[model samples]
Target: MKTFSMSPAAGERYVPVSCPVCGESRTREGWNCGSYRFARCIGCGHLYQNPQPHFDGLRARYGDDYFSYELENDANFFDLMLKGLQDAGFFELERKLGDRRRFLDIGCATGMLLAYLKNRDWRVQGVEICEPAARYGVEKRKVPIAVGTLDEAAFQDAAFSFVHFSHVIEHVPDPRAFLLEVNRVLEPGGYVITVTPNRAGLQARVFRERWRSSIADHLNLFSRRSLVRLLSECGFSPIGWKTWGGIAKGMAPNFVKAPLDRLAKLAGFGDVVLVVSQKISRKPQDPPVGPPDGAP
Candidate 1:
């Protein structure tokens, strides 16, 4: 894995703009943390940090050090268990689809999920933007991966039976265009699954701006309603959905955290949202456009 170093910017820059989901321009607000400032659209309730870095900039951030940190600090026994649960979710998705011959995983970091799917006899292919990560997948795991963005990757249309984007949508610049491309490359009855942070979750309410998930990389925030609406607009039918899992479960906590963890999981407000939808031949009607005054 290669690492590229670059000088940090002296200050943050803000760009005022209307809401992308809705055309309301009146309720834009600024989110400031130290020297960083983000222009959040109150209209559609989308929070985006300012001075968004380009693809190369992101690649530099995800170098060897980043993976080392993830492996050392993030990936543990509990993390492994959580990953198993996530793979179980995908397994259920596979059953629903009734077949799993081909699978495409976008933003497949280190190709762990693809490796898991491959074990299930699904031919796994992945598209990753970071060079080091893609190389690791190809060389270490022997997973076939296209080392680039989805739009730039060379894959035939309708090549995949299952397309997945776990925790990847928020990092994308254009969610609609991304999904449109997903639809283009998917077979007529293929399934598309996405998992991302739900802005409307209880964690968001408790942590507010300081929520760990509210970071510089997440350009879009989607609540359950908003996510469903966006998927419908992009021509996917909602088939299955699940909400939050406890953070304490990832930590070696005693009995004190157990009850709270159970409650949080029951409330479906942990920290992440998973959605499974299938691609259909007919396009669904667009969601009713909200008012221009930020009234959702």
Candidate 2:
């Protein structure tokens, strides 16, 4: 594994939070990529950053230039096609719902997905952690974006019919708690769609920690098995899921963009994973009624 130095200023501070999945205390490990501080949970083998940077800090790290870079140089055409693929997932969700329904997108960076769904007449709302990106989405794209973390947002429970969180779960401090919140906001039988980098993929094995997905922002590293387990524990029943190599993964590094980069598909090393799950309403367990009288 390639090792990187830790910045003295960045490495000096971090707050401790219990493991999101196992509820275990996390101990500091070291600095990763000279940018992110790392902590590992001995109970669940889940790694995270202690006292991770806030949303504002993350926004500073990924400025407006980053989106432009993605739009202009980094796999631009391929990403558009990937959007179509993501829409296909949304379409499947529509079929499952049997009606036009509201959709909530977490980490909706530039509102591309929200815009796409809006065009299809689905009620679209988004929660974004990056203030600049959220502002840009509202000002430039006219998207209905809420700027902040989901926990801080004032959305009512059981409001949304569908929710999508693409590549955002790994960045969360508490995956279990986050999913519980997702369940609370989603109506019974509402679908949750997620796409993440597959830690069990061949590229992960070949590249190990050097895999591009293992960047500074990524805290939790989850294999497909682990992700499935986590979701099950969080009260979601798996609808369908799959693993496939994405074209952009291969063409992203080279400025030479393609409609669909075939290197990973051809070599079979691309590391994209898809999961679809549904929220099941748990039967309300009533609290025992206290004795009417003052009898002890």
Candidate 3:
């Protein structure tokens, strides 16, 4: 549960950015963390870090410290991922996929999830930004992992039947582009599961600027509505949505946390959300349509 500080390096370039989802420049000032500021997009209710660090600088944050953090928490993270997928009824979908079970994990740290899936008869591939983490997964875990960005990997078209990324899209410099790359690599009718913190959840409303996910490393903070919109725009149709993490560990007593967790799952509001979607067909060269409403 250690959050990355991601302190900006000296002379690192920072630039203002429009909302990645709705493509709007108008935003309301949001939480002010120590070194970074968030902005709520007026067009689509998307929260993102504005005047963000350059992509290269941001990518450089995942080094030795990040590797250690992922290594320490890999098992816990893998368990959570399994629970999330199970809650989303992913096993049924996996069965439906039959022998066409080519899977890809983006930003896969140490490849624990991929390893597990591989053992379950999946042909798995992984992309990791941190070199050490990728090396460890490849050498120790005996999993196939490429050390670089997804775009840099240049995978073949329609390469996978299942694509997964947990808590990774929020760190992307351009989520739309990242997703398009996903779309390009995903086979028709393939499934994609995205997991990220929910800015509109109860914890965020209560904690405001003090929310655990309001960290410098998270460039985008997505709500359910914003995320659905983004997924639709990126050629995915959401089939199921699941959320968990009502109260963070140690934040409240077990009695209080237990009920809150139940309520979070029942009411569709939680600290984190997992969206399961299927890729829809779209012309590769077609431009992304604008937001639904014309208010912009």
Candidate 4:
């Protein structure tokens, strides 16, 4: 993905926020990309943009320019998402998931992944915030895409068996609320696969503020621990995870990049991470207790 330029508009408001995962207010500056800055939470080691641009301004960024970018990179994104899902054993899981093959892809730009799975006998739907991209998916790709946020889609409870979102949660200003909405719509014991840039990866550490992913579009950057913790708290139990992309293109020679990529996957410190989790079934009278304090 290319770096996005998102300087704040004149007189635009930037709201400060606490850590979404742990509700921690203590944070230290992490990095800055253009006019945007990231802060690292002292409580859970979470990284997010503080003094975030107003929601309306943030929403405005996903117009025609963003649509063009998505259109240009749809094929590459599809391949990467497919590989990530395969690495997380989604293909085998799908075969054993009985007849309830419903799938929902959030932030499904152009609905490429939805169309691909729809061809594989899965009932597919998509939620995309970009109007032009959603229209393209619906009209050109023949995929059913709702042009709105998942919460705005207002799906029925237990609507889908599988939920997937790639490079999406980081853009959300309220990721906890987003995950709760995801949990509400997903059937009990259903699966959720999340792909996002890892803040605790080699690229972020090496490139620091210059990292491509530390761009203006991303509001939150999750590491493996922080993301898994957030998922568990949001009513899901992590089953598996995979990470890749140790060195980005043009960053290193092929010989070096190849080994680093393999090593990143094996060592669990890639630039991006894909986590697969199952929705924990909650009885109507179940306690409101949270996940274990230190369970791995």
Candidate 5:
């Protein structure tokens, strides 16, 4: 895995750090790729790249070719994403929320999903960290995009009812603080869904450093236990979870690969995992005790 320290992309901005979730200084060697090494936090079992790029440095690494590459290659990317959303029970959240129309997609690159939803009449807002990416969404796609990180987006309290971001949590430097910001903007019982790589899955176990997730930019990695623990700590209630992907065993026909993939997920050995959680209502104050049934 090419790293910020070795590559010119990140420049002289890399620094060593402790685990963001557990604040643990002790770590076990998890994997090494190129010039970087990943460590598993002894306190929480979270995996992270020990010396990662500074925020500005990481931001500077993304270039204009980011979205256009997908435009040229994965033309049906959004369609596939919509299908994945349905599979992940996003529509169920829509049904449950009923009248709550606002949706926020963090790290919404090119605002494709937001633009798609906006066409369907949902009040959509997006936040993208990359300026070029965010500007494309705003200027080209005509979507409402705020160009910044989640904590810097400055959304109002309880501003949205549904929040979605795929494959972004792992890149965050501090996931607990990131989720806290996510929780702050979501209304009570609002739906939140995220997809990230599963370290406990077969892909990581088999390929080790060769897994797509073993990269310099992916700062944090989580298993089911660590993911739920972090979410619960940040006040998100569990809704649903499932492991998927990890079809890297071989190039077989879908007829063969599909069942094996399903079995892999069912047995908790998939590469990617989907988690649906919600921001629950804060604990209420003690119910008002009336004084003698109408004392002025």
Candidate 6:
């Protein structure tokens, strides 16, 4: 739960940019946390960290301790993650995609989730950005992990039946390309489950500029509408959607958690969103008809 502070080095890495998901320029209303700025896109109504740390900046910031910070350097990290995955979103994927074929975890980090999936008879593979984190997964957790970015890994086309990631897409420099890569590796009718902090969630509304999810490292903060739109554009058709519930934790005393959550989730205002989508056919369209080759 420890948030990364925007250091002088990280700040130096910042270069002002526009919205990645939407090509439109950033709106005037935005908040500055230290020197970093989070802006909303006028076109898509999405919030993102403009002037975010580039790939090199991200690499410099993560270094060695980032994994330790993420793992909490705790012995029970895998155990804790297993329980949470089952209780949270894993079962939903399982129930939908009954047969477990090939599974790939993008930005798997220490491979806790991938390891758990392996236990369920899945042929699991992971791609991690940080070397230390990838090594930890391969060495200690006994998970098969590739050390590099998604584009660098070069997985085979239609190689995986299920591809998953939590809170990782927001960190990518180009989510559109990232998802297209994901679609490339995923088999036809494959399932993809993605989770990210929701910018249009209750907490974001309540906190406004002070929302915790609008942190330094998180580059894209998506709402359900924007996220689902991204998925459709990337060739994934959403089958199910649910917000990672925090209404019970963060709701005020006057608010009733259950009823509020039912309504809030439908309205796409949850702290996090768990989206289950199936990869649709992305084949090239046939050439337009004019006349026969000899006739025209």
Tens digits of per-residue lDDT, candidate 4, 106-210, equal 999999999999899999999999999999999998999999899889999999999999899999989989999999999999999999998778897788788
Encode model 5's per-residue lDDT on 222-285: one tens digit a residue: 7766677777778788778888764664557888778978897788777777789888787422
TM-score of each: 0.81, 0.75, 0.94, 0.93, 0.87, 0.82
The C-alpha stretches of model 6 lying farther than 4 A from their native spots are 1-11, 73-100, 247-268, 282-296
Ranking by TM-score: 3, 4, 5, 6, 1, 2
The total of clashing pairs for model 2 equals: 1
RMSD of each: 4.5, 9.9, 3.0, 3.5, 9.4, 8.1
What would the per-residue lDDT of candidate 6 be over residues 1-296, giving only the tens digit for each residue?
32444353724566676766656775555666766777766665667777667778776666676777766743454554454456456677677667756899887888887887789888999998878889988999999999888888999999999998877887877787888899999988898888887776787777766777777777887776677777877888888777744464544553677777667766766777778788899653322232211100
Candidate 4 lDDT (Cα, 0 to 1): 0.86
Clashing pairs in 5: none
Model 2 spans > 4 angstroms off = 1-12, 26-40, 50-56, 59-89, 246-270, 283-296
State the C-alpha lDDT per candidate.
0.67, 0.65, 0.87, 0.86, 0.76, 0.73
lDDT of 6 at 103: 91
Regions of candidate 5 where Cα sits further than 4 Å from its true position = 1-10, 249-256, 283-296
Of models 1 and 6, which has the larger TM-score? 6
RMSD of 6: 8.1
Model 4, runs deviating above 4 Å: 3-7, 283-296
**What overall lDDT, based on C-alpha atoms, would model 5 receive against the true structure?**
0.76
TM-score between model 1 and native = 0.81
Clashes of 4: 0
Tens digits of lDDT, candidate 2, 63-143: 555545433432443374356356447566687676648999998877777887788778989998767778877887788
> Against the true structure, candidate 3 has what lDDT?
0.87
Looking at model 6, report the run of 10 residues with the lowest lDDT sum.
Answer: 287-296
